[model samples]
Target: MIKNRDIVCIANTTWFGEYTKSTVQLMSRLAKNNRVLFVEYPFTWKDTLTTFLGKQKAPVSRMLGLKSRLELINTENGSKVYNLVPPPVLPVDFIKKDQLFKPFFNLNVALYKIALRKVMKKMEVKDPIVITAYNPFYGLPLIGQLNEALNVYYCYDGIGTRRHGKRIYAIDEAFSKNVDAIVTTSDYINDDKKKFNPKSYVVKNGVDFDTFYADAKNKVHKNEQKIVGYIGSLDHRFDINTVEFAVKNMPDTLYHFTGNLRNQEIKQRLDKFDNVEFFGSVKPNDVPALLATYDVGIIPYLVNDINKNIYPLKINEYMAVGVPVVMTPFADLKDFSGMVSVAENNETFVKTLITELEKDSRSAINKRIEFAKSNSWDIKAEEFGEILNKLLENGND
Candidate 1:
């Protein structure tokens, strides 16, 4: 493990948020041997306004200067993550032209640097290894300014998602080349990322086994209605058509969802089904038990540009709890072909789901549990640490 080192992560998510993401899970594990700092999402003026208006949930007092922006967060692994909230930035997305938006972009980066530098100096963080987690716009500009040992572009997703707009591809390419290493969560993403940086590596996502494993053993499925659950952010990524087909075909089965519903149209359409139930986002600690109730877990994603390179987190969470897994063939599943069943189209998806419902044996469950145990966060974090060590050893900076 990389011990006694200062690790700074410039990430797109909150330290304590609705979901327990890969960044949070890995960073929390890494913090056991290193001083980790989680730089939260760069909030825009619009985000601040929404938070103020109670339309969004955020660190309101910290954003408003009522409370400190930087604090030490105690993690479950008995390590602390220094979470820092940078100043609110300009919401320049309204300006379509690059020439018009460049000034505001520079201004936001400038303001962000001041906030980050202040916190780093106060905490006496020196020779830190910086990991820019999916914010390539700011990641590109903040390159040589942080007085860091190395910068790892942690590209969990491809560019052009979320706030990474039209110019993200070029910006992402530039940032990838400049960084010491590019770490990805899937081989599909790695194929593109490694074209820019040779140091690119795929440290696939994993589960917190102790929690989910216990959930598998402890929680018994009590419902008479055969439950088919999906646990992830309900967005455009989720295939409503695939879900609708299954719901209509299998009227006896209960369809459950547990994640923040982003696409309202999905809710409007899927809610009309009497069998479908939506359990909105839950605490990270509570997820294992909730997933344990599922007879079968699914990744019903539309095979779009984003889903083509995607690796949903729920796969491991589901398997860890001995739940039979089924999914639409969105990304690479060469590693999991033995354990997870994939269907190419909606009709076949329903068919595969029914087959899963019909035949789930103790051997299959044991195999999945073993797979989950092998791909635990404990193992993934160590794999990541090895990559960090290799980067530092090579003197990539």
Candidate 2:
């Protein structure tokens, strides 16, 4: 019901044809009623220069394709995606010296401020609700300059736990305290944010049920061969040892991983298993068809502080296609006990996969589909809208 308002979302992800994450999903849905400007993370001169010189032809092409330093692309929904080119800034991760870093960081902020002013003027954006995800360094500087009606810090990950996160934790903490509202994807993140902002709320991730559920009835793989699939980024969070054990234990089952492999060492480690197949990144539209071919979906995440807080969207995506999920122990998995088979370790995870594959029935599929329908992106967007409405109604008092 929050309609006709201008909403400016500063996100870590790019809007130019990539895997849709929570920010993109929410903004897309919100666009049905509101005017949205999705500002992608600014590209530094180094990034542009590197992309120009890099062997990756696609990125170089995309960079060259930019019509303007700030190009606006109109979406099917009532939203505009603005891609910004940032001035050269010190790479915060590599630069350890404060004396050298602060000057460049300040210059980066000043340059962005000018760029943002131009974007606002071009779009005729005024008194907009500013929603920022991940990059607090960018958001912190723009806090008072924009004349934003409300400032929302959307925390999707335990960013402070990561290697490069230590440098920005203090900035994030300050941003959280100053923001009008803090929205988090998990309870752990929400609890942490509440220490700084009492207005923090947990709005967990959801799936795009329409696209996913449409293919739920399509049982393309009628073969007797069982396919155990894992989708999403194959990064450090992925439990390679658990997957190795599971694949080794179940020689008959075909293990398929569909995603961009961030950790080459892990992929190399798992390559020895002939049963394990790696299908490098598939388009988001092609996911449900891939899910339809899956006998069971596995979330073999390494249990750690970072992984524990993650409410995996793949779990919902798998369930949306009526595929039973076998996941490693995570705090948020407790809510999904009925739909997902939670496993403590490699032994239980493998056992659960076998059990789910053996007992895959119409009744179970229906149950999962029904549960997924209730947690669609539409529903989550409505819940998020309600919170935003309350904030606007109260004038962020």
Candidate 3:
């Protein structure tokens, strides 16, 4: 087991969010045996301004050190994580030209580097294992500056397919080449990143199986209102037509969505449906309870550029809850081909979900729970640690 190591985690996503990311869970689990410092998202000055003006709910106090910036967060199952709220950077997203963006990007890096050095010194962190999750822009400049024993880029998405793809891809490539290894959540992602760096490993995403499995036995909702639910950010990945078709056809069945709504127009479009209900956002701890209430879980993702590289965690979450899962064939789901049902189109997706909801047997539920147990966070953390340990053992340090 990888223990007693000072691990520095530089995540693209913040430690605090409505829905937990796979990176957060993996780091939390690794915290059990490691001194983990989680550096959160670097919110820009624009974000602070917006928050101060009551436009957005950004953590302005924590960002500005009005409140404690460095907090010790105790995770469930006996783990300690230091959650570091980073100082805001200058808004650089608007600068499209590479030459102009480079200077601003370098400034942001210097800003973050100075701040991080102070915290590291204060925390007495030495020769730390550096792992940046999906933010190569920040990851590139700090490559060797940390005096890091080993550098690992834990990429979860192909940023080249995202907005400002061309701009970000170049920096990401340079970062990939400099890292000791690249760990990805899907083979699809690993395949893309390996072109830049061959020292890439595909350690797929896993769920907190024990929580949902335990909750499956507890009855939450009393009413026999069969519900089809989706628990994630209703972002661009959502196949609108597929969801609309399901909501329209299954008028009697309750269609539940529980996450942050990225687009207002999705709400405008779906508001007319009486069967559809949006619970906004629920805490991670409350997810199992919510899962228990769902008769079936649907991952209605469009086969777009972004969705093509994803390995959704909600699939296993639903599986752990012992509910049947039905998703569209968006990405490479070969690993779960036999375990979960995938449909070719919207009509087939709705049909499969109906069949799943109607004939969910005790044996099937048990099988899903059992399958999910093997892919728990604990197991994935172990796999990740083993990889890190191998790198360390092979003289990467």
All candidates' lDDT scores?
Answer: 0.87, 0.80, 0.86
- Expressed as tens digits, the lDDT of each residue in 276-318 for candidate 2 is 7888888878888788878899888888877877888888899
| Residues 91-164 of candidate 1: C-alpha lDDT, one tens digit per residue | 98677799988998899999989999989999999999999998788888999889999999987876653665
Where model 2 places Cα greater than 4 Å from the true spot, the runs are 56-66, 70-90, 161-165, 218-221
TM-score-best of 1 and 3: 1
Worst 10 residues of 3 by lDDT: 216-225
Query: What TM-score against the true fold does each predicted structure earn?
Result: 0.96, 0.93, 0.95
- Ranking by lDDT, best first? 1, 3, 2
In lDDT terms, which candidate is top?
Answer: 1
Model 1 scores a C-alpha lDDT of: 0.87
